[model samples]
Target: MTQTTILPIDALFSRVEAIFLKAGLNAVQAGALARVIVAGERDACKSHGIYRIEGALRTVKAGKVKPDAVPVLDRNEGSAIVKVNAGGGFANPAFELGVPELAARARKLGIAALVINDCTHFSALWPEVEAVTNEGLAGLVMCPSYATVAPTGGNKPLLGTNPFAFGWPRKDTSPYVFDFATSVAARGEIELHRRAGKQLPEGWAIDADGNPTTDPEAALAGAMLPFGGHKGSAIGTMIELLAGIMIGDLTSPEVLDYLGTTTLAPFHGELIIAMSPEAFAKGRPGDPFARAEVLFEAIVGAGARLPSQRRFAARKKSEAEGVSLTAAEIEQLDRLLDKGLDAIA
Candidate 1:
């Protein structure tokens, strides 16, 4: 029975907000994060949306994430390089504060970087990257997380399932954005398989013994493998350094230690860079968008779709007809709703 529930996007927002509120978020805070979650669903980013909501609430209850946290701008507040300390809160609003500021600085200075530390990221990176590109600037954002995936050729997990996001804008089409996890299989995709009692495909993950396994539960209990083997692992390592050593944020080992003590959201860090072509490239007559559109046409004419075409296609269809969710998901939400709001915490 293909029982799919189709609802307006706002309905999803309201449901997510209600759940966040029940999990101890104020209206403003809940609204801020709710938007991130909703945008994930809107873009068909299943892993970063509903799949991780419960974990976010659990972290809040565990005191790993502070609901009322406010990020403090560091001493280098108003320069080309920007930094914000989240004091161990959600990274959604932190990026909300940093993206626009970074875009502004990049517009004026040609390029700018923003580093946010001591924050927990619970959503997709496209929103932040897209935000910068919307301002007519190129954007690249890298976020390092806890050690869930192992480095290539290593038994134990050494690095986070880091996300690398980049965006380029176009004049006649949607922005070109690519946001992906370095793991062979995304964390949420693994979770979905586990929930459905299905095994993961080959190359996704391995058992605790270092041998690869198709068992989703065992893989989750052990570690995820890097996509493309060492190449992906190397990129993950680079992202860790860029978002950690480069900016001096809490690294993966520290996050693993923090997780050992509590089930809360692990404090993490993010690196965001924005560049304006008006300042860097041919300034007067060179239109970056126009140049990119030519390549886009070439690629499409060659019968190849771009990186984000599927997501853009999905978003268009969803906007017109609405989005669908499995009955199991709705049932889970209903069960959570049935539990008294105060009791959820």
Candidate 2:
């Protein structure tokens, strides 16, 4: 078995940015992608970290991603509602361009909604939501993808994993955040399992024939299941309609069924809503943050683990001991960097 290699966070970020810069990304885009990667790594989200680089590169080469994309603010509805046209590229820089404007509007209006279309979501959503919360606001982020999961009680795959994320600021610690797929597992997670030659948990996926399987290879070639049977399917539906359709973009099934498969991540669009707790509550005693503090006290008093608590712990460890990566994964990255444009786009 290959050993894992650990490196300082700074080193990792520098190397990842260099690789992206070689792959048609501008300095700003490279830094944005690098930050997203570091966030996933320090938070122990391996599936969304360096593991996703090759897949991202493939799409860039395929012309599905405009590495030089300049996402534009299409419309501003009042002080709280906005729209972004992402120029059909990665969502990271688009959010970078749009978030500050939307956040400014939110701080003024006490709430804001930014609907984005024509952007591909390749990383975890929590990072974006966390960004909003870190800037002193509550947030929600969600996106739709190609049809790769079956709804409850049906054999055929009818929906995508449909990721949803939420974030809230905290008084004494890091922000509380959670990001999850409505499907039993994310495609990236399944890919990780497959790469490691590991079996999957029960109810995670089905074979091409629509039969349940614990084999990661079969699961990838087939379909992932909804997480909580009908309940998860329902939430997946809401995300598909809200982030996909309501955002004036094609839903997961629509993208696959009509436009057909494009590349690695055909995720069409995303939705982000930010709200200022102070704006709503005026932040008096026992107000929004204080009330939330009371709730947090009760939760921890009951010995409950808060959302992203593990991630926070992992981040602390990474800061002290450096980030770790498998030797094989390191080799892949090194080779990509060495080959340059020929290997990237």
Candidate 3:
């Protein structure tokens, strides 16, 4: 077995932030990026963890993302829509900037939407959804990625492996949350499989000729399949319409066209909707939180596990102990910190 090293969560965050700062990201961008990345590692979500660092650095090195851009928030008063322009920076900081206002607006209006535009988004959406839940609101987050997944009946890459996430606040314990790629698996998973010299599960992707492929290299060069065929295809299209076109941002195809290569993080927008459960449940039959808990108890009673339960368990373990990384991962972090953008290419 490979040896591993455990580092405290704060220690890992400091290292990640240092890497981004060395790559020229501003304090806001670097700090926010570090928090989400560390959270992913803490929760055992390896696809969004340290493995993503090099791609972010590569984007910065190629000038595809602005390392020093500070996100600007627009309150858009009296409207249900709040806007944050990422100013060509990473989406994490922009989401951080707008979330407070989003929570406040949702409480005041019963529902509100935060529209983040012109951001290079590469992280998982659960962190953002959990952020909303932290503010005692339910949240739904979605974003379009590089054109990577093929539509149900299509042979070419069109729809992205668009990710969607939802979260509900809980009075005790971790919030209820679920985050997943609309594709059979996230593109990051395939990349990880490639790095480990592992073949993908059979239904995950197709080759350039649209034939099923288990090879990661061929899948990367071709197209990923949607999760539930037509159902997933429709939802992916809906994300493109709502998060992309409706928000006046680039669609998946447009993102692929602009990026020219999927090697870098895709430049796009994100949609985050926040809703106040209490406000929605006002003057209703019973307490919404109470009812939700009862439903959760029933699900568990039936021997069904809740979404994100394992993740929360991992997070608890990481908090008490520390994040564990293999020797190679540690070396990679050291190299990234020492070489900055040059470590990628």
Candidate 4:
């Protein structure tokens, strides 16, 4: 068996934060980033975990993202739409700055949307979705990435891997949450497969010649297929329309053009819609939360697993026994802290 080292979640977080600080990221940017990245690791989502640090550092080194940007919140009083301008920084801090107001507006208005603009996003959408659920509301989150996915019936890369996430609050237990890339897999997964010298599963992607391929490098050079063919393609287009075009931010194609490469984090916008279940169910016959629990129990009773169950299990284990990292991963973290951006390339 390969040897691994276990570190407390807080210890790992400090190391990650230190690396970002060394790379010149401001406190807000670094702290928020560390929280999400560490949470990814703690939940066993390796694709978005510490593996993402290098890409973020690369983005910083390229000057494509502002390391010291302070996100500004525009309350837009009496309106259901709240906005946070990231000033070209990482998206995590912007979402953090806007969430409380989003929750407040959602409670007051029954539904509210938070629009995050001018941000470099490289993390999973589940964290943001969970944040809203923690506020006792249901939430939907989505964002466009660099163009890397092909629309159905097309071989060229036109749409982003584009993630979508949803969360519903559950009392006395973890929230009901699901987060997934509209593509067959997230772009980060392909990168991780390449690093591990592993072949991707069939149907994930095609080569530059538009032929099916399992080679990670070839897939990276070509395009990833949408998850459910036309269905996923439609959802991806909707995300681009709602989160990109409607929010007045960069679309996947525009992002790819502006950056001219996919090596850096994609600069785009995010859309988060929060709805108070209590408010929505106020005049209805049943309690929404309790009703949801019944539905959840029935599904599980039929042996159908809920999404994120494995993630939550891993989170519980990590909290109890600490996070386990391969020796190479630990070494990489040490190198990052010591060399900062110089360690990335």
Per-candidate TM-score against the hidden true structure: 0.87, 0.88, 0.94, 0.94
| Candidate that beats the other on lDDT, 3 or 4, i.e. the better one | 4
Candidate that scores best on TM-score: 3
Error of 2 at 162 (Å): 0.5
Off by over 4 Å in 2: 1-6, 75-79, 188-202, 206-222, 257-263, 283-285, 325-330
Weakest ten-residue segment in model 3 by summed lDDT: 336-345
Taking the tens digit of each residue's C-alpha lDDT, what string does model 3 give over 170-206? 9978999999999999787899899999999989999
Which wins on TM-score, candidate 1 or candidate 2? 2
Off by over 4 Å in 4: 1-3, 188-202, 207-218
lDDT of 2 by residue, 149-220 (tens): 988766767788888899999877788898888898877788889999999999999888889989999987
Tell how far residue 212 is off in model 2, in angstroms.
Answer: 4.9
lDDT of 1 at 217: 87
lDDT of 4 by residue, 98-137 (tens): 9999999999999999999999996889999999999999
Among all windows of 10 consecutive residues in model 4, the one with the lowest summed lDDT is 149-158
Worst 10 residues of 2 by lDDT: 258-267
Error of 2 at 279 (Å): 1.6
118 in model 2: Cα distance from truth in Å? Answer: 1.0
Candidate 1 residue spans exceeding 4 A from truth: 1-6, 74-78, 191-199, 213-218, 261-264, 283-285, 321-345
lDDT of each: 0.80, 0.83, 0.94, 0.95
TM-score of 3: 0.94
- Tens digits of per-residue lDDT for model 1, 119-211: 887677888888888889889999877788989888878788888999987665679889888988777788889999998999989889888
